[model samples]
Target: MPHSNTSQSKGLALPPPTIVLVHGAFADASSWSPVIELLLERGHRVLAPPVYNRSLAADAASVRSVVEQIDGPVLLAGHSYGGAVITVAGAADNVAGLVFVSGYALEEGESLAQLQGRFPGSSLADHLVYSPYPTSDGATGTDVSVEIDAFPSVFAAGLDSTRARVLAVSQRPLSADAFGETASLAAWRTTPGWGIVSAADHTINPDVQRFGYRRAGLRSVTELDAPHLVMQTHPEEVASVITGALAEIG
Candidate 1:
């Protein structure tokens, strides 16, 4: 392939921006494993930081820390509630773009709880199981989890029951407050963005996903028929979208 003058000027077609992936509630950084490999194969630097689902502010701070430590421009991607975290963290100086994979892109002062019902396709409320825990201030806090039996139907409908069962058993619960806490900034307002909206998503309504993308003025969107765990179920599709965002911003 012949190189463009732009590539020569940059010494090597400006390498793809580093990708920082943020996993959502009920899942850990491992959820991004498949996508991570795909991105790596394509010669992209990737990082997945573990987010403490205690509060939006705390989660955003964690993501921001990762973004800051990255040496160059960053492409920030988030799944599920992690979308909300990136919405705040993407405001960092290093972030070049945002990618929302089955994520909620809240406006300033909006929250996951508020966005969950905005389009009303979620069946999550019906499948939740709550347990009490101690908070930082020593007060009681409620942690919400999905019923193991209902996990396949509500969060990973496309996966086999056996696989979904394992995921459910290993799932991490999020603090009830994380969902209710309001976001202070909407990074999508200033950052270029891309979205992967899962058509069969029951965790975060598909229509709501569209609404979020539209609200964020995303550069483009790729829709998949997979469920909420689209990245796990269709890693190639999700990886392609991330690479697409890199190309768009580059």
Candidate 2:
């Protein structure tokens, strides 16, 4: 399922594509600001909504709400945990393409637990992960979350000192329960998609991201010496990948 030839040209036509931004755990919608801005500047409409930001279902519902506002085809994109959220949200009729920014792609019968289980010692998760809570955010199960220092060390690994600090403070704490939800659909398998591999990422290992990229059978793939937050660490490069995907799917 690997892509054959990756051209920087145009292909199919989606309904004036509306790019939806879904942020991973410990972050809100603003996590995609730079990338969203880049795409918007390029004449595309962007929808970066603040999903439940913690509750997986709530986040998916937020994505659905945004999708409802748009008129046609959408390039639903998610970062980190947001990837899982979009997998469900994009199942709708209008999702034309998908983008995973150092995000996870769950298999039809798998959950985040099983996928991460495949890469237990990935440097990315070891450093950033916090212990699951007895009742995180009022939940009744184990819910591991991130702390401030680990947040930057893992997520903004490629960011400048200033930006990383800002991201740590701005990060939102998602409900620990979101990761446990089983992904009901294999969105990547059924949809055209692409992934941006952050070579220097600390939150999610570069190697692991590549695994997802390859397994998802992306239309095209690109790697960058960016942080886990490639959207913020390398905005233009991230946008260019999206541009590349748009061209291929034009």
Candidate 3:
């Protein structure tokens, strides 16, 4: 039998929200592989889409497009830049809640660049490498990626050095505009939210992550002793928090 949006067993009702996972810059949908396994084991429908790291608005629109195809309510989750994408895309009507795994939750009119600088922990500015790419109008646009040597140490410190090195080599770079674009809407304002704070994160300061989560009024917050790649380093922990978020809205 097909699963309905709501299920009844005994006298209680269960909410079956489709889980949509979004990855941040320097990554693709594969970043959610670990977490996907856990969510599926728990019987939740999950979708992890490729978010082209070109511009914030464009990435958000890509996420929105994926959400629109789902047949039921969604629990949208994002990491790093992915968090910023969901903040803009989560405004969709079918979105039920949001999960931020060491992700940014920018407010209206705020850019990820501005939010990262709000606190003093991130070393991203010092490690970034930029290249020029042709834009729609024939002018050049900046593409940003972290130095290969800096990736394992700065972005994935919580993971093994070998794995981090591989991730660094295969990482995707985001357009400079993605970091500078101001968010049009903050979905967390009206949607229930959950946050996973990577205590040892270097990409985005842990303090900034906490502030974003607090400012958004997240219903639940989990602090883990991990780095920016918290979802990868601590997938079970990340999944636990996501499960909690799902329970809250149900």
Candidate 4:
């Protein structure tokens, strides 16, 4: 059964908002494993869905579908590129709030390329490996992934070596087109938001995270001296942020 918590403002009981976790580029829903375990233990209903990493519009639509299926309010939390996905998806009527964990918070008419370009410190560009794949229309599409040997140091710096190695090899590549697609909506403009900045991040550049979160005017901003994979290294802290967002939503 779903967890229920009382809304002090209405003086009535309501089911706690479901947390929808969206994974970013070069990663799958499994990236949320540790955080999911913690949220579940606390009785929060959590769904960590996989984003296609194909394009912003398509990915957002996919997640919005998931949110609309839920019975009650939902708190959409996304990591990395997943952040961009939720930025557009969180506009769904059922979405109550957003939590950006080492994620992007883009504005309308902006693309991930545009946002990242504004801040120039990320080393991710240098480490990316691009390859061609066949698209549905029989045309070639480009997939972007980090070099296997460089993935651990760049994307999962704080994670255990053995686990990081496994993750490196199992990464989900993002379509190159996603970088250039502009976001049709900026949900944070209307939705309440909170953010966690991985201060020592190398994958997306900590400054990029800071700039986006600041512009979004998120309700709360927490900075941790962690790496790009803050979810893996600091699951407890990430869960706390989500819990806090839920409290505010109540």
Candidate 5:
């Protein structure tokens, strides 16, 4: 492949690649603040694309919009449910690599519903939904408040009081349909992979994350002794992992 035109210039001519950070359900871009700062410190431009789980298809379009605005290579990553979105969002042209932070790495047509079917009575399932309601896409919606309650152990078990409080107030409603929708491609299959395993994650089982990432052929792995909010719990380590992934490609 031809080098980007700027690569031809002498010193400082190689412009930094853009690193797009996508947050998972029940939270927004703020989740990646610490991690994003670390990436910026290393001289890469970071883009945290905001998305809503209820708006699954719209999330894809929003991701596309973010990718279009950038002029260089993209290093895309997502936490939790956000992982599925980026698999579709950055799995295409120009995406250089991906990092999955305790996220569901799915294949085409696979939704959270389908995956959770393996074990339906986990804390999350028990607390979150009784039955689905109609959504804008003619699909079903869920009750997300139940998510925070059921997975509190997995997510905020060890968080600082201040951060934990913020988490409670910031958690948003994620749509039910997004979970059941499978990704067209596992971006990690094409893009080099980095997986963040939160050993104590309750919201998403740690074993599940490990299994999915291994199936994707990830060679670079980092384990955090945190809860479900892996990135939020230990952003510094997570940022270092992101930097490590860049070193592999750079």
Candidate 6:
């Protein structure tokens, strides 16, 4: 049977919400590929949208635009920096709930830098490579990415070395400005939420995930003994968390 919600007044079944998977910095929508495939096989409608990795506000706006266009309710699950993006974007009226997968769940007025700084254990800073990119205004802006050689260890730990290397070379870079920009709104503050903490994460400290999720008062929190790329290394576990959230939402 298809997943659905019950209408209290009409005795009708509302269609299951479309799941929107948002990838974090240093990755694209493809980062959700493993989990996406699993979700699809389980008869769920999913969309893994690209995050521009520009500025928090811009990225959140871009995601919000996508959510706004969906026909029914949306279940947003974000990984890494994408968690921050959805923290802002999930405020949409159609957004029914949120899932944070090895992600940073920021509070209102908190910047990614602020949140990560508090935990102080991520190896991501040491492995980051910054390069200058020209902005639309003809100004030079900094783009931050994981160093290719170090990406496999720092970001994709536990994945096949060859596959990790490919991800390293093809990684998307996030704007340096995104680190300092404060989230104007925290959707998790209002929306029902679920979270997953990659206990072995090196990109973002597991403590950071725990802290944010606790503050958000999420409905459920799962801790996985996985690395930063939990979606790839533990797709089934990640999918289970999402489907669990869906079941509860229904």
Model 2 lDDT, residue 193, Cα: 89
Q: How much is 243 displaced in model 3, in angstroms?
A: 1.2
Off by over 4 Å in 4: 1-14
What are the per-model numbers of colliding residue pairs? 0, 9, 0, 0, 10, 0
Off by over 4 Å in 6: 1-14
The deviation in Å at residue 57 for candidate 4 is 0.7
- Residue-by-residue lDDT tens digits, candidate 1, 41-140: 9788989999988999999998898777665678999999989999999988778899999999999999888887676657888899999999878899
Using Cα atoms with residue i matched to residue i, what is each candidate's TM-score against the true structure? Answer: 0.92, 0.83, 0.92, 0.94, 0.84, 0.94
- After superposition on all CA atoms, how large is the RMSD of candidate 1? 5.0
Query: Can you write out model 4's per-residue Cα lDDT over 129-194, one digit (the tens) per residue?
Result: 999999989999999999999999999899889999999999999999999999998999999999
**Local distance difference test values of all predictions, in order:** 0.88, 0.72, 0.88, 0.91, 0.72, 0.91
The alpha-carbon lDDT assigned to residue 242 of candidate 2 equals: 77
Model 5: lDDT to the true structure? 0.72
96-212 per-residue lDDT for model 6 (tens digits): 999999998999999998998886868888888899999999999999999999999999999998999999999999999999999999998789999999999999889999999
| For model 5, the run of ten residues with the poorest summed lDDT | 1-10
Q: Residue 108 of model 4: what lDDT?
A: 98
- Give the C-alpha lDDT of model 3: 0.88
Question: Candidate 6, 39: how far from true, in Å?
Answer: 0.7
Best by lDDT: 6
Model 6 TM-score (2 dp) = 0.94
lDDT of 5 at 152: 50
Candidate 5, residues 1-250, lDDT tens digits: the string is 2243344443335456778898887788988887877777877788897886665557876786677556667788889888778777765566788889988776566666666565433446555643456776796666455444444554566777767766876676677656656666566767788899888777787777776787788867787888877776688889888888887878
